[model samples]
Target: MRILMATAAVTALTLAACSPAANDQKSGEPAPPNPTQTVAAPAEKPVYRFKIGALDAIALFDGQNPVPNDNKVFGVGLTPQAVAAPLTAAGQPADPIMLEIHPLLVRNGDRTMLFDAGLGAGKGQLMQSLQTAGVDPANITDVMISHGHPDHVGGLVADGAPAFPNAAIRMSEAEWASIRANPEMADLVRVITPKVQAFRPDEEVAPGVEAQDTAGHTPGHVAYLITDGQNQLLYTGDLMHHWVLSVEHPDWTVGYDDDATAGKKARLDEITALRASGAHIYAYHFPFPGLGKIQTREGRATFISEAQPAA
Candidate 1:
């Protein structure tokens, strides 16, 4: 899902729409401060470089966007206090949670592939980030999509046309089918169909990249596993959004998930498997350049972001 612009009226409307009538009594409680009002200092550079065996992987920071932090948006069955605990403990704001959008770039020899296209022109900083990374859209040989959400597919087109004209746009066959069938996504499908290369679940979309079925967030949703020799990194599309809530409370279903039950199961299973494998993960909606490893401590999974390089 795309990050929506925050406005007082819109925020109020969203909270009202998602919460039950019983929560209205809390209206007397002071409204939570809006996090978007506080602008973050601009990142000095948009590119975060790391290696996966011999392959070079780069995370391109698109932009940080704010979403309503109501319990309805995240912990549907839990209280705000429950959802806010992990955030507070992590030294993060407990209201108006900000989510970072980072599209990944993986280079293997002559192949240059983009994991996901970010929010389209005017909405995100994908193009600017690309320039900062010294990546030319024209030179990209492959455009692999993790899912069909706008944030993931928007950057695929620019000026009403495919941005990476020469590149093959890869998506799961099931996802392609869903996109074609959904009226809301018809326009997007039309623009990308020309280059769309639909593959089966678990199929290798590239030399070292395999599509792992992780449906639940959306019908036909999938994640990518990029393996370079014995090293691998899992590009989790939207399996989990918030680093804390999603990791510590895998059972809590976010409002964006099409099938909350399925999404919860997928999250639990994926985190367990990733923790066992000890593979690094790049969560799309986590912090910018969301590079981290999933670790289990006393039966709880936590996302530990890798330390940033010193300036």
Candidate 2:
């Protein structure tokens, strides 16, 4: 019996040695080669340029923050499923929602203005984007803020000093007051106090640019309107973040809103007005280069992204 077993083992080994390897499945085709080593490329810098009426506007991409996909962070009274439905239907991920941060650069004649500073210092790409757009930080004549939130004002200071030494910082009076009352932003206020040019709600901060009160995201959250007689564009700061959830379901409260009820009302009113007028919109947290027009059908507002200009 031992001799027979040894013979059988020897025969099996001989047959296996003559057979093809596992990877050589095809009868005549050569075995697939090993995968080549790969190196990941650096992220592309997102900078979009377009016209806002006659004014040249460049969308400077700051970056995106991932937020928890929970009812507590989004729709306070609704379930996570309900909040994610719109995003899912739009082929977007439902969890860990990505919130984009964009600041606008507008140039009319020799005047240059930056809408919001973005995540300041080392946290964002505003500086790189400006360089790519052939803009100098020192040459920025005006820095128009929608609100005094960290992302908006954080870039105002670097090493406890003004980041844009030559630019005059402007915001609404209410926003300035709100920032002063918040102890957490004391450092920021101290550095920017001298340059702060607080304006009335509807005051014009620059030529062809007017601030519109759109409170609720913050007490003094405002939107800017840029018009050049024949054309117009609205820069909706934080009135809405995700285009679909914010525009389609304006009643849903976001976790970041200071007053959810007021936020909802402001979003509804602003979106409705924009939709009615067919004005171009630049949403800070929509998609990159968030230049688009809102379309309402069957009581639902849909964001239609504008096509990028040809290279």
What Cα-based lDDT does every candidate model obtain? 0.77, 0.76
Error (Å) of candidate 1 at residue 117 is 0.3
Instruction: List ranges where model 1 is wrong by over 4 Å.
Output: 1-42
List clash counts for every candidate, in order: 0, 0
Candidate 1, residues 1-311: lDDT per residue as tens digits?
A: 22232234223333432233422224355432221111112266677888989898888878776766677778887788887877776556677776888899999989999999999898888888889889899999999898888899989999989999899999888888888888998778888888999999887879899999999988889999999988988999999887777887888878888889888899989988877875788899886567767655444576655524324
lDDT leader = 1
Name the lDDT value of residue 34 in candidate 1: 21
Candidate 2 per-residue lDDT, tens place, 194-288, comes to 99898987877789899999999999999999989888889999988886688778878888889888888999898888778768888898766
